[model samples]
Target: MEASFTKVKGGALVLKGEKKKKHKKTKKRDRSGERDGEGGKKLKKNLEHEDMNKHGGWWQTTNLAHIVGPVALQFYNGAYMKALDNGKFVLGAPHDEGQGPEPEEILMAMKVGDGKFSLKSGFDKYLRLDKAARMVGVSDAVGAMEMFDPVWEDGKMAVLGPNGRFMSVDDEDFVVFDQDKVGPAQIIRIRSNREREDMKKTEIPEELRGNLYQVETKFVKKFQKFQDHKLRLNPNGVAELVEAKRGGNLHETLLDRREKMKSDRMCK
Candidate 1:
């Protein structure tokens, strides 16, 4: 995908894109702050305010094992999603850091129709999959990719993409890779190292051996081990995806970076 030139706003990279649709009003939330579904039935909010304060901010992994343990999301210069002109979004890292995510990284977690939410980026662009619906990107067009289902089963919260895959990352760059892209996929494992150490292998029930991990597949034995992360809401109410492991040499695959640079050159 072709990348669009970014404008530096307050010394931060701000992606330029089509304007976002102005919301007439925020979604109607019950007294408990729960949003209602299309039928007007109350649906659970992803992260309660209490949880947000305790955990930090949106889509951040606060699992005990991740916080002080070996596993942590790599936050090099702080990561944020950037959309390219060719219809692909890159999770750009090595960005300037101050307090939290930059204004451009703050995404609006709008309650679109149904119980799902659409992420509207600071560029006023909606995050959606490509025309083929395989790769994810931000666009002005409002399509299926913009709409994502919030799956909070097994004591975990995950955003189901348009391709029916959950947002996940592999050993590769911070760019999200669809777990279900190939076969049976694992969602997330939300257990701290201490919790895992406290549990007795035999004493723990087969079902609850770990804190909370999900596998969605039938007859597929092999699945990728994914760490569950929580999405936190900033004071401004914008949500940002956090990582499990922090500080990773700010690794950006040369191939991927080259492709993006090529796109940028073409854009000029």
Candidate 2:
């Protein structure tokens, strides 16, 4: 064996050692493409939550302020159709088994948002004198106005009728002593604008179903916070929409949701 002496230039060591251990690397997940199969379902769920919070749908956007304006307008639409066709909100929500917003009601809501007419902040609480002045902008004034109800009593303001009745400054609507009877009786008698009976496939589409549910859920939750606020407004919306309607009881009042869910396809 020949032994060779190594000559080092500039004191640098060069050595060949044992092999190094290979470490495993974890993979990074791409959530966007991951939402397929079971992953897809989870992605859908997350997306639904995001959309409901920011972009609420039409009927949902129809808050109390919006409803009163649209209601007043629908009354006009009904009166117009009634004149042109017979008398009632044109394209009224169908009467009978289906208890829900009608196409005409939807149309009226659209029309109101279309800039055809606008309301002041306190429009709902407007007295006969004020509402009368604003009546010119409304299409039909005939059945638009009426005097019905229980007067609202406040130390500052007092009204008397079934507390409140739909009325016009220059007109009068028939009064029903029993509140329970009138809603069902009249609600069932109206006609809807759309002939489409399948509410699930009718008003809202399937893809939007999840988002719609989110809107209602959030709104209801938010509305609950207004308990003390309700006692303040003319008739607290918090009271009527939230307090007045409770679990199970609220479900009983609305039409069979499962049945309705099967047909409604609308979402504005």
lDDT of 1 by residue, 1-268 (tens): 0011123346645469856555545454343244234334322333333333332332344332232221112223235444445545455454332233334434454566666656555556666765444334456766666776655433444446766765554454333535543222224322112233322355732432322121111101121222343221112110111121133211222223334434554697
- Model 2: per-residue Cα lDDT at residue 214: 44
Candidate 2 local lDDT, residue 228: 43
RMSD of each: 30.0, 32.3
Reference-based lDDT, residue 48, model 1: 34
Backbone clashes counted, model 2: 36
Model 2 vs. true fold: TM: 0.19
lDDT of 2 at 40: 71
Q: TM-scores across all candidates?
A: 0.35, 0.19
Against the true structure, candidate 1 reaches a TM-score of 0.35
Residue 176 in candidate 2 has what lDDT? 21
Please give the CA lDDT of all the candidate structures: 0.40, 0.27
lDDT of 1: 0.40
**What is the C-alpha lDDT profile of model 2 across 1-268, one tens digit per residue?**
0011123347545568856544443122334345446787777656644533332211222222222333222222222111112112222222332233432232232223222222221112212212222221123321222222221111111111222322221223321222322221222111123222222344643322443344334434433334344311122222333432454343332223333332442331
